[model samples]
Target: MANTPQSKKRARQNERRYAVNKARRSRIRTYLRKVEEAIAAGDKDAAAVALRAAQPELMRGVTKGVMHKNTVSRKLSRLSARVKALG
Candidate 1:
């Protein structure tokens, strides 16, 4: 459906970007899942470690435009609170 050369190029670029962003999103989710599992298992130490590891990944998602700043901020805030409550 991309008749114009520019449109075709844009479509190609979009496909590549989509793949990259999808992978980034998946990685972020994996990190979050680790934190959730640790929390669910009631291992405060492990949960804290997982939360610390996940924080940077979530921020990276924001920096890469895969997620919003406020969304990541809220997620971090909630997760940190839960981790703290585990104490």
Candidate 2:
């Protein structure tokens, strides 16, 4: 579909970026799932630890433009609150 050389280059770049972003998003989801499982199991200590571990990965997603800042903020806020309530 990209007729011009520049457009073709951009298309290739987009594909690469898409793959990278997909992997990043999947990684972030794994971290979130860890926190969720800990919380669901009602282990406050484990939940806290998982939350702490997920924080950086979530922030990295935001910084890398894979996710929006406000979205990450909301996710962290809700997760932290749930973890806090697990006591």
Candidate 3:
């Protein structure tokens, strides 16, 4: 429980930020899923396109503090490797 006014305000802010970050994370997951689907379909071109589209979103997650830089980098690396192997 927040006893002080500032703490209460911070709680509210945290809730709002949590929701926003949740949405951003979900959006990023959707993009990653698209890339996975493309790879599963063995369509290298589509996977590459999906990866291109997802890279920015993943980077944005890093910038927005929703995800860590190294986390995004590792994800991008694994995805790119999978995409490359799709051929």
Candidate-wise lDDT, in order:
0.97, 0.98, 0.97
Clashing pairs in 3: none
Worst 10 residues of 1 by lDDT: 78-87
Q: Which stretches of candidate 2 lie over 4 Å from their true place?
A: none
**Prediction-by-prediction clash tally:** 0, 0, 0
Q: Which pairs of residues collide in model 2?
A: none
- Candidate 2 residue 10 C-alpha distance from true site, Å: 0.4
Cα error, residue 20 of model 1, in Å, equals 0.1
Task: Kindly report which residue stretches of model 1 are placed more than 4 angstroms away from their true locations once superposed.
Answer: none
* lDDT per residue (tens digit) for residues 1-80 in model 3: 99999999999999999999999999999999999999999999999999999999999999999999999999999999
- Residue 4 in model 2: lDDT: 100
Decide which is better by TM-score, 1 or 3: 1
TM-score of each: 0.98, 0.98, 0.95
lDDT of 3 at 18: 93
Error of 2 at 67 (Å): 0.6
Report each candidate's C-alpha RMSD, comma-separated, in the order given.
0.4, 0.5, 0.8
Q: Write the per-residue lDDT of candidate 2 for residues 1-87, one digit (tens) a residue.
A: 999999999999999999999999999999999999999899999999999999999999999999999999999999999999988
For 1-87, candidate 1 gives per-residue lDDT tens digits of: 999999999999999999999999999999999999998999999999999999999999999999999999999999999989997
Clashing pairs in 1: none
